[model samples]
Target chain A: MTGAEGKPAPGKEGAAVSGETETAATEVVAGAGAGAEADARVGVEAGAGAGGQAVAGAGAATGVRDRTAADTGAPDELWARLKAYEGRAATVACAGKDPVNAPMIRHWCEAMGDTNPAYEGPDAVAPPTMLQAWTMGGLSGHEGRTDAYDDLLTLLDEAGCTSVVATDCEQEYLRALRPGDEVVFDAVIESVSERKTTRLGTGYFVTTRMDVRVGADLAGTHRFRILKYAPAARRKPRPGRPRPVVNRDNTGFWEGVARHRLLIQRCTGCGTLRHPWLPGCNECGGLDWDTVEASGEGTVHSYVVMHHPPFPAFDPPYAVGLIELTEGVRMVSNVVGVPYDKVRIGLPVRLEFRRYEGAGTGEDPLVLPVFRATEGGA
Target chain B: MAVTADRPVTAAGAELPPLEIPITRTLIVSGAIASRDYQDVHHDAELARRKGSPDIFMNILTTNGLVGRYITDHFGPRAVLRRVAIRLGAPNYPGDTMVLRGTVEQVDGDTATVRVVGANAIGRHVTGTVTVTVPAGGA
Candidate 1:
């Protein structure tokens, strides 16, 4: 979703357009150092808002829309034209930074804290999910990307799909990637979904399919999807607290909250226990499950101090703990009864069911499980 | 979109099961980003506060998605959501829980009308009516 707006403000890169599809992007980017922008910071100002007004502010900043409307019939038409690139190979990213190697594999495994012995020896195969890792172009930027890619972004940007995020990625490994295998790949713009509205806002779903090869052998295909859209309006807060989102998978867990009990899901198939209840057992694939009441005793496996977003419902820099219960399952909840800075990993703690009144916003008393330090010193 | 007379309609006063989902930073950021919303108010706490919000708030898109999920889940995959009218009432900031519950309001032919309320500790986050056309067997 990086577009002309991403390049600078339109004030910096104005002389670009779209009557012809191919050189239109090149000529536009070639127009890059326009240099007459005494008021170029308008783009920055517009981005700072990032809400409904921001796009309009950005549009007002450059008046790029008037020209866009005139040139391509409309921005939507420009988006439709991008579908032509579908089913075509993108410019090759690179021969890949290096051949698949054990050192990098070791590093990745270590970073993920994986300890499988099968990964350490000469017989080791890189993790199947590491398929995309071998093909990354990294921070220096991918070498083989063409202007077509940037044009798609600029077109989307001009249409005000300024924000972008990778929604999810799906990868299938056809075979094991071993050491000294030179990895090469080409990606295709497989499909662009029609404008669809979601919980985020309205935008297109762009799926890129990457085919990975090792010495002409098809290794894997990685499919990644990103959503590009204009942010929707924020909801107006009512007097009461916001409600919890519950579905079939986790309804029983909330019922436990209502009853002042912390329940963990136990797999009847394998007698394995887990938290944040799942409908099926991750270990045994068992759909039949039961509940186990938590002993309320655990230790801080890890913790985070949240400070950036301050809400009337919570104090800033509060510590949220990932508590590993005595029953051997971990859940995240607020860490109470200690200074935010003092909460530590492995600190023994006790869980308490507590209610937070969301500042008289008319939200009902909210009940949750939080941890309290039993005895601790850093 | 089709419904069968033999398929039992959800009783008018019956409550759809309540769902309890924990709201976290990952959920808030991913949901917003996935919905193509780059509004800083949904992700950046500091920027949101500067923009006069108490904190980064959930966007309407996520709310809409959840509501859609609420109906589809009840009637199963074969059900088609035709119309959903929702009004937002509260902010679903990170760390809060959102409990969604619904009741059947009316049913005519293949279409059944349902009303849903998504409430958090602070209060109702969303209240709306959803019209879903279920399969003849209530799929």
Candidate 2:
């Protein structure tokens, strides 16, 4: 059962015992030096050997691992895993029929904080963003090929890709999901191309489409950009420097900064508060607002240290904050004065208006709320 | 096909007049993924046949997007999609055309109500209404 010399042995019970004995016998027959010397191709990286090298490694340990992990020798196991999702497979069919489904209208209503009976009411209906919620729910389980993008990834992985990462997702919603309605999904592979090499490895960029339906009616489509990685050597991080602040927009908030009191608005109808001074409340359809002063203290709901600069005005390793304010509203701002490694969830933060320069010339003072690490809580 | 403007639309009024726009591939695809829908009926011809459908069916998500897009296009780019209520009446198969038609039903200072109808090659595919906020002067 021992595979040939250079091949990797798969991790399976049936093959392990027999393969070990044969492997010992082969070592004796080929001789220690003869095995490596006889197989000159053995020195190049383990996986990418030539046909001759492959034959030599056929019974070897390396061969088995690769074969088993790939869809070669362990077809039954892979097939079993894939079949587990037969019921939950991604499709362009109506969603309502699948009663136990994720991202249904009920789930969306909860996520968007819509409490009105209108969505479920006999006469009233749901909002258009419901589609966005459904899509996010579908993509939550990013591992399977029940959808087009997942199918494409499965195919690429079968074709010998090492790793895959989702780069971007853009969705344009057409309508909202209504009660008693079934949603269908359509998917297609848009394009694939070899992208530039990165620190991780050389990779390819793949794009795919998923079209939705509700029983013969057109819904919306989602375009997904995915990155597939190839093997590469690792690199070290460069010397650290202070991350720069991103403060371009927010002139209006900064103008209010001169007033000395922090001001925010609440919808007159629904009592929902909003920051950045919106004309109306997204909830309750109310236009008039009541101003309130925030305690300027909030918790960091989620944040990331962006290593790559999306725009020229920003630099690497800058902390971007999504803070849930004391007023129960969430806003995206900079988490200033904190070290790169210190940002984490539930970290207490305070607000202070700071000036940020525009990309071109003059610096514009913007009111930015920066978060710092709390002293007591773990 | 070109059609005459149905009626004049005022920005700051109770409600802007309804508009009808044909469904395009872009909007169709957007709705599909926005809803995370992936089925043969929505995109695959052979699969649709296997599933007892005439052809690839239009997705509910895509319908929602189109209806919202149609209203927003008429209202102005700044209008956000607040809510839409519709019941599917008939199937909207590929190659069949559909229209997004709506009318201003009510107006309260900042919010206005619009009733809309989605008709296809058959007749009415979906009928419902939406409430959206327009800038004070459509500015």
Residue A226, candidate 2: C-alpha displacement in angstroms: 32
lDDT of 1 by residue, A148-244 (tens): 6566666666665654433334444566688888877766556555454333334444555566778668777655445444434444443343457
- Prediction-by-prediction clash tally: 32, 69
Interface CA RMSD of each prediction in angstroms: 16.7, 25.1
What candidate 2 keeps of the native contacts, as a fraction, is 0.05
DockQ of 2: 0.04
Q: lDDT score, residue A63, model 1?
A: 8
Tens digits of per-residue lDDT for model 2, A144-176: 223433554454455333343233233444654
The alpha-carbon deviation from the true structure for residue A232 of candidate 1, after best TM-score superposition, in angstroms, is 1.5
TM-scores for chain B, listed for all candidates = 0.88, 0.76
**lDDT tens digits, residues B1-139, model 1?**
1112233456577677776656676666655543434456567777756533455666544555556655655565455555554445455667888888888888887778888887776666666677766657522
* Runs with alpha carbons beyond 4 Å of true place in candidate 1: A1-78, A236-378, B1-139
